[model samples]
Target: MTERTAAALRVVNAPWLRPLIFLLLIVVMWDLTIRIFKIPPYQIPAPKDVVITLWQEGPMLLREAWPTTVATIWGFLLSAAFGIPIAMMIAGSRTIESYVYPLLVFSQSIPKIAIAPLFVVWFGFGMLPKVLSAFLLGFFPVVVSAVQGFKSVEPDMMDLARSMEANRWQIFRMVSLPHAMPSIFAGLKVSITLAVVGAVVGEFVGSNYGIGFVLQRSIGNFELPTMFAALVVLALIGVVLFWILDVIERLAIPWHASQRQDVFLAA
Candidate 1:
């Protein structure tokens, strides 16, 4: 094998090593920056202190994080349930597109945090508001991506399907739907991360639970290490969620062009 092939094999076989090394490098740099500048812990706790905090408070953090994780997943599922059908509806007809598309675009322009309070008012101080926040953040991307995916089917393929006496539903099922998987998956990857952010924003605004609430409390109390630790857990949640989606995408659409490129890059 060529050197490129060997390097690709290493990455494929030892997937965790490179990321771990990078994490260690970041921790080292973070520690060095604080030490070199004599920065105080209250402003930016050292990595050692952060690590200690993480160990000390891991159980409590995990308990707080559970609600946020649930809200994130529930919101993501709701967005997917609504977004795909709405996208198909919009894509299926010009009348529907003209009526709904502009409103969707307008909603996207508004900052999520600005409208989060309204959701709280409508849904009250419950998980519903957080779920709605996550849904609002996640919904638009799926609609856009699914529409693109549906419309991306080649003209020649459509003609072939028509010639073969395929109905609209049949054509969509066999060609358009498959063609759209990669794009849908792409939207889902983005939406999931945004869902996490949405949940945190909701928690920050009004909740008495979640890692985000813990973070806010830490900030108020000036517990820099606890704040840093909460942030670390939040980061891990996002990374793990994104990775899970990526894995699912690869498994679901292994024949997609992007997946083929990924395989080529890997080996």
Candidate 2:
């Protein structure tokens, strides 16, 4: 291959490079849009201005980020911890599934954002409201995904385990749980991102600190660049959390078929 073609081939083979390039391209487009439209910085600051805002406000931003991060993590863990067990109860007993599953589905239909203000009113302006708001937002997906995962075990595999005289717990531990892991992690990745949003919603309703609170304060003072900077931090939080989960999923289930799909990318 020619030198240019060989270099292109190498970039294609490295998984992260393409996305990095795409991100740069979008930034360029964003800058151009502002310049072409003569958009005032007060309305939408340039990327460079945002970078400067981040640099100037970095420490304060980090300080505020901790509360939201804690809330998100706690809410996500709460959903996962409670969701898996509830899912087990649902999958293990058809009667309970019939009664409880509908209620779960109906609960998800309610607008979670509407409930944020109520949480604040009840819990005051503390972390509890934020964590509960996030839990309410993220709980459904975890339960649904966990239930699907638990029920997804093939009958034949279950039968083979039973035929081998494996006790119910043994069969579930060795076969069912492992089989459900990929799905459970899938749900977790989605739930964590949602939890971040939910936590921010709570902060928006009422909070003394957090990246979300920063956004609210910036808006009142008309510090658009600072507001944008806060948004960037929030985005980074979600991206970082998602990436961590992705790594965990790979480590936890390396043998999964989706994890083994590198051959297609390499090709």
Candidate 3:
């Protein structure tokens, strides 16, 4: 390649630039496909139409989005609060692991969508149901990853801590917790995104608020542009929440090998 062309290719391939470039390419291809095939707007709105709808209805969308955002955050926080302790208990004892782990797995096997209506019925279409749904979806990942992290702690390190006269709490706080942070953060990141999905699922089942409701309404009315716009909002919510967890992970575990690799890439 020519020197200037090679420089442009390297810039586009950069870690930070790659996603935006890919998104732009997708949008371009979408617009081209629509034009070439003469697709009906009602069947599939053009990208520009979706963008226009998003801009025109931005305020209303944001207002509806607030409830979903709140539900997602609350649900994720609840998952982390309960999941970590449960994981620790399970990791600390074989009996607890044998009994609780199976139950946890069984709970996940039940489809969230199948039971979502029950939450609405029991909780009365309130934020509680949404929060509960999010909790249910986000909880398993945290517990599983945390259990793995805690169990992965080296026996040698524990022996060293005991040799130094460190108590259980001190050893856990200083050694186990630090070693498990990367895995915990990985689970948190997954949980946060799933929480967003759970929140939307809750809204889909029963709420009168949130982007989910907007999507349902747009679908019923066959407002394809509005439907696409709501979908875009949902995608943005998931992306932003995931990105926040990633930032927090990097900050919280700067010494982690993964984070060190990220630093190397950025440099």
* Candidate with the greatest lDDT versus the true structure: 3
Over 128-173, each residue of candidate 1 has an lDDT whose tens digit, in order, gives 8888888888888889999888878889999999999999999889
Winner on TM-score (1 vs 3) = 3
Estimate, for each residue in 23-46, the C-alpha lDDT of model 3 and write its tens digit: 999999999999999999989899
Residues forming the 10-long window of minimal summed lDDT in candidate 2: 258-267
Q: List candidate 3 segments past 4 Å from native.
A: 1-14, 261-263
Candidates by lDDT, descending order: 3, 2, 1
How does residue 38 of candidate 1 score in lDDT? 96
| Clash number for candidate 1 | 0
Question: Relative to the true structure, how large is the alpha-carbon lDDT of every model?
Answer: 0.89, 0.90, 0.92
Window of ten residues with lowest summed lDDT in model 3: 258-267
lDDT comparison, 1 vs 2, better candidate: 2
Name the Cα RMSD for model 3: 2.4
